[model samples]
Target: MSKKSRPGSRSRALVAATAVVVTLLTGAVGAGAAPATTAQRARPTVILVHGALTDASVWRHEVEALQRKGYAVLAPAMPLRGLASDSAYLAAFLKTVSGPIVLAGHSYAGAVITRAAEGDPRVRALVYVTAFQPDTGETAGELNARFPGSRLGPDTTVVLEHPGGSELYLRQQDFRDVYAGDLSPSTAALMAATQRPVETAALGEPLQGRPAWRDTPSWALVATKDNSLPVATQRFMTARAHSRTTEVASSHAAPVSHPAEVTGLLLDAIRGTAY
Candidate 1:
């Protein structure tokens, strides 16, 4: 009987070579394929604007905290002149940022941001910290006058015909008691000495457009023990603006005295706007 036909050594070698070539060809195709490009992550920029009688320094703690958490934070020095001019200035500044923004305002800045953010689709959220949330045709002064508990009237000093309009300052003697009751006396003194004055006209300027909060999501921090802007007044304004609100037992300088709480509120705003 003829020997059973079997694969010859040459045929076996050819089969092995083909398998190696196939494996190498498969690997080469995979290696040459383009890697999936990860979509660039988007993060909203946070802009913190200070109110009357204070500069951007007030947001130091908040800035530090937010930065540590990987947020892009900016505390712009707002020209605390008349509302129209300041809002225009801020609006111009806003135009320079490339992405969505979470705008935060303290005291008079709330009104400024309200005006600045109007008609701007990039502002995703508004945060009012012991701030004035004025409606159209309403002034910060009007909002402050709506309630009677504020102790700021007597503590303020006015200078007419100053450079940027009628300037207003907090009396150094009353700064601690009226604006920063929860802060250390030394720190409060330094704050009083370095506080930036606001033009009186800014407080009286009536808002020209519907507040951004009317259409944007909003968060408000009510300083319960505030002596500058009455807590009740803060509540009323926030309620009118339909803001998500939280109250802390703090003075008007809540951002300075209870920074953690203030920072917490701001982070909440950031999270609310994130997809």
Candidate 2:
């Protein structure tokens, strides 16, 4: 008779075969797992900064939409003081973020981010939403003065009057017309009631350093119907900054009224900018 195999030997051979098969399967699965792409690995945290006459609450819709898309978002309450102070505050805040940042600004906050991002490598991109993109020596007030479509001048009132500086707010009656014309009446009324006043000194404060836009990739949204910052001014600034541009038929409150459009531009910046 052919030499019969021992029972223990046969069992050991079967176990060895099963172990080899399992090892090969595990290796195949591990090899097939793809590494994260540059786009996935480089998604920077987005920091949204609100401008004069508005607080962080104004970005509610945008915050919701960005969060839904799995983007890390922060809408920080900006102290609308002098530009230097505001920019310093933002620069300090940026230190708290763990990774790369996409800094976005609305209205006057644009100037703040411009200065804040200067020499800061962490800020990968800048987004301007109907915002004031001031050059090194330029001021928001000067930019607004250049284009005259804004009705904000008449709506403003002095909150803390002083020879050196003053705080200003949009009159409740004119807030809807000037700032939130496209919003529902009730919504406009609420925004008007809760509007934050900004320092006149802030508007006049000259930028301290070279604009971040000069070095950083930028995206801009021109609200065609914006009465606060004229669409022409928006176009001029975006062109000057060499930024990727998008236009929407909305008021200065685009974040609130046309949140989808605003969010789309921000996503574009996030995707286009490399980490």
Candidate 3:
């Protein structure tokens, strides 16, 4: 070589080259990561909370439908122990999720979310699918009796007592007429046999805090033929909440019997809450 390079100069040259490569790679990664993050923030997560006498399985159709549409959905199992405790549990669960949420509750799950979503800014909207939307100091039992035609009563439910508290299940014989009138008898029978029992105290437990529907935008599905919660009661509750409402001639088990309708209403809520 005409001029031999110094070791120091050679080392510096190598480091400079490495820095340039790293900068280029970092810039490429940053560019790719930005869009992914934006997409995640753009869509709100849909959290479906099932009510008493059922579990997350009730949202099977909805979960699949929404997933096919590229939406993130979760149907968490409600404790169904009592209003205060169940709401507390849901509120805790909500804290673990990131970004925004569109919370939907069915039947008694409505009251759960009504209290669970309180003061949570992440909950952008509330969807009540033939569910209770009890205000502060209101109980589910009280709301059920606010209107006539609810077939759910002592006659239709079987009570079981335990050390903790009593639980109630829809009698297998009356389950079809009371809960899943729109579903086939076979399907209703399976539901009846597999239905979960709810703590009887949950019905009388009042919603302790401010209902989320009071502040959040709300959508409701009024099952006109609902035997567990009458159509008139659904209308009254949704009206009080000033909810954007849809009416379907389904039973209390709208998600099971009218899955498409339930999915459509949930999509409306998702689109509505999207930023």
Candidate 4:
């Protein structure tokens, strides 16, 4: 994970969806049909999934925080091009986790986790941090169209704000008012310089089956000041999926703004859903 002043979303790409038997970090969430005793035991494996255009590095702080709290975590790298590619990758990853598992994702990756959760019984819970939690048979594109005035994504090819800005790409100074209103000028500039460009096709693809969230105990972190994915859209998705909710006054980049809070929620989900 890059240090402070790093640009863009640092996300570990979700490679595949295989059931992975993992060890618990704090609570007794391991091996079986949901656990009978629900006291804090050991931290289970924490799998972090990244959104489009970004890589696995976005989860740096949360990953470290989870580990410090005692979780054997894994954040898979994903194929940013489309949902099917990411889903297949996640499916393969979960199959190997032997015990209770907490699968989490941000932004577009939320849909990826949703698609992979079905049929795979190993996944104990989910965390959607400012992400898109898709419903049964609905495509990401369909959800984008739901807002009427506000689509889930931007149409133009997300371009780089500067020539030498690494991979960070977004509208100039937009985060100031929308996503990262609380951030300083320097911080916002850093995010802009490192922003990754999400593949255009990733947004339009829809879910083909039931979302994994329906059966899984789910938690969501909504960025109230987001400019990228509308806050209303996130609310709609959460309500439609019937997930446990938490709100933060950040931007679309909640992990970046509030890594501590994100990690804490993830821990709670893993411990509570420990089986």
Instruction: Choose the strongest candidate by TM-score.
Output: 3
| Candidate 1 runs further than 4 Å off | 1-41
Candidate achieving the largest lDDT:
3
What does each candidate score in C-alpha RMSD? 5.8, 5.1, 6.1, 19.9
* Per-candidate local distance difference test: 0.88, 0.90, 0.93, 0.74
Task: Put down candidate 1 lDDT per residue, 1-275, tens digits, no spaces.
Answer: 87765679779889999999999999887776633211123678999999888899999999999999999999999888799999999999999997789999999999999999998998989999999888889998888888887777843664657554578888989898889999999999999999898888788889997779899999999999988899889988888888999999999888899999999998898888852
Residue 99, model 2: Cα distance from true site in angstroms: 1.1
Candidate 2 ranges beyond 4 A from true positions: 1-42, 154-156, 162-165
Pairs with steric clashes in candidate 1: none
What's the residue-level lDDT of 140 in candidate 1? Answer: 89
Give Cα distance to truth, residue 221, candidate 3, Å: 0.1
TM-score of each: 0.84, 0.84, 0.86, 0.74
| Candidate order by decreasing TM-score | 3, 2, 1, 4
lDDT of 4 at 27: 30
Q: What are the per-model numbers of colliding residue pairs? A: 0, 0, 0, 62
- For 70-109, candidate 4 gives per-residue lDDT tens digits of 6788888786667887788888888877666788999889
Better of 2 and 3 by lDDT: 3
User: Which ten contiguous residues of candidate 2 have the minimum total lDDT?
Assistant: 33-42
Candidate 2 C-alpha lDDT tens digits along 131-230: 9999989999889889779886743554668676788998888888889989999999999999888888888888877899999999999999998888
- Give the clashing pairs for model 2: none
